[model samples]
Target chain A: MTVVDIPPPLPVRDRTALHERAPGALSPMLTRLAEERATGVLVREHGTLHLAEGRVVHAESPLAPGLDVLLTARGTLDAAAWPWTDDIPAATHRLLVAGLLPRGALELCRLGALYDAGYFALAPSSTPGRFRYGTTAAAGPPGAVRPLRAVPVTALERETLRRRELLHRIWPDPSADGAPLIRADPVAPPPVTPRQRAVLDRVDGVRTAPQIARELGRPAFHTLVDVRRLAAAGLLVPRNTVPPPPPLPPVTDPDIALLKRLRDALEAL
Target chain B: MPGIDECLLEAMRLPGARGAALVDWTSGLALGTVGEAPGGDHETTAAEAAELARLAAEHGAFSTADDTEVTPPVEDLIVSNRDSYHLLRFVVTSFDATVFLHLWLAREDGNLALARIRLGEMAERLVLG
Candidate 1:
């Protein structure tokens, strides 16, 4: 008799019970999947994450436009010639055969899109949706699908934190993150860097950071940082209707002495 | 012919290579990294290097005579300390010249001239689609 080997069957769960889990439960579910070394697609309400051996190899979300759109935006791929499909390997091979880009460039763009969309996918939304773990060959939703080098879950989480911190450092106000970019007067035009100028040119007072990023064929995170910096520089129109208060004047020596005396007097009282 | 990872690995193969990273200067993000970081943290190192690159790329004083416009004026920057040398080689892409390769080398064994030539060639050949 000849011996043969067969892979084990995948675990399956109905969709009805998936939503029964508590809202904002993706972190824990992802942790569980990572622990099991699960290989499949994790489809959430906002987007989908493709995993291989418990590592995220690709991700897609409406918030972050797909690689095809980005390439088209850059004029590398003619919009009419671009291929639209959910099959990542096929699309990748098609792009490669057309001599549109090098293998490394494709890999970089895939990783960039994965991280960009991953940030939004893992974000805390108003309502958390269900997740389905399909077989290893399962395809993601109909959107931009590109293959990426598998990234560990821990690294993705760390990168997300880093991006959040980078945004906060540039401008603390999170309200402007998704808001439209409007031109405004800054007393005098603030000195702008070349990159910021490029971003400013794209600002039409209608598109949000992510949208502008898609149009410019740049990473969404990079666009967010530029918008925040422009806001901080007083270049973009303020998100709030009311203007910010004028900066306080520098305190003189007399003011410091006065403050010290007031503190001493309060202590004595 | 080389991918980002392979390029970084090639950089590390250089004499006295300590660490290497492919960074997007605009966003201060590391696309990929290899070996140990000089500042003990790759993120911090990348951010700091990006700041330097931005400053050099923006300043008019660094602009070349042939190029009156301030379009990514500087091609590369080299900073040397007592123990190590930091090289920031700008890579021009079809879309934007916002990416660069950062390599940290120990002074004792590193050849600054050879490293500079190799990085320049790598930058010219880099393809980010």
Candidate 2:
């Protein structure tokens, strides 16, 4: 992903001006820009909100999580779900016009994901209550447009959204990508719960199940069983590209204190 | 034939059953709690239970090698201790949120197979808001 700084307090333009001038409209409007074809970032404005798209794909928006990152996080949607189809901008426009999802919701998904993926803060939507388009410019990746045409489109999208929300529940740290892999200080005492203890027995981190068993002096099958139990308890973090975690809320209530205590006790073992 | 409350009540009815609760996983909020927790802190236990669900959901999302993509949305999570077992079963759906039943039972008294079957039956009748 490319990053371009927006000049301080970008002069806001009207929706029609954006629709006619933004890259979102440029392809259709391309026949008209008789000079040099622009190949940078286009930030479209609708009221105060902006939706950004590169020539090949959308980078960020106030509404949607980055589809690629969201899909990666869900793990349910393989990379295949986000195959590169020509004309991503048009496809996005079509998805919006088709009313499959509200434009803002889509933007939230992308924006939320981008935020989790380590991007800039999303500005609140400033688009007028009336539907219209606008434009802005940012640094962008070089590539032709690519649209998403993955299978179980609805399923993929929903799963990714669910995963995104789940990640937000933990910390903002992107390290835990839903893997069964977890890291615990070996020197720490085992947790009180047998389930947690079982998890610790399997944490070699570098090896798969069979290898973990050899190191721990356990049967491969038994090790797998224990590993599955720990995984179910959410004690393991898988290795690989992790999805953005759900946003964790500040622990405010007194009950949260006690709960954290129990959690710590359990995981410590 | 059981309602949401009925489900929890039924889970507690099992031999050696200790306590039960209904949790909404989306927000990790326990909708209701029944029976006494070891510390007699239902509120805290419920909150913790939600955290467990959150963790499980996160692990599921990032573990790409697992068959989660093929496995139907998780219907249940069961954790066993030396003396007891804790079961958290998700009520399956495609809506914006999810609900689950959390049950605690004495290991010596609990029948895992039976409990699973009953939980599955209970999940189908749950009325999610």
lDDT of all predictions, in order shown? Answer: 0.75, 0.47
Index of the highest-DockQ prediction: 1
Return the top candidate by TM-score: 1
Report how far residue B90 has shifted in candidate 1, in Å.
Answer: 1.4
lDDT of 2 by residue, B17-91 (tens): 899887654334444567867458765676678777756754545334544432235567898979888888866
lDDT of 1 by residue, B1-129 (tens): 467888889899999999999987766778889998987999889988988997898766787777533248688999999999999998776553377899999999999999999988777666742
- After the best TM-score superposition of candidate 2, give how far the Cα of residue A81 lies from its true spot, in angstroms: 34
Instruction: Flag clash pairs in model 1.
Output: none
The clash tally of candidate 2 reads 46
Off by over 4 Å in 2: A1-269, B61-72
Q: Please provide, for model 2 over A68-95, each residue's C-alpha lDDT reduced to its tens digit, 9 standing for 90 to 100.
A: 4343343423445444454334444444
Q: State how far residue A156 of model 2 sits from its true place (Å).
A: 34
Off by over 4 Å in 1: A1-26, A88-90, A96-100, A136-148, A238-269, B59-71
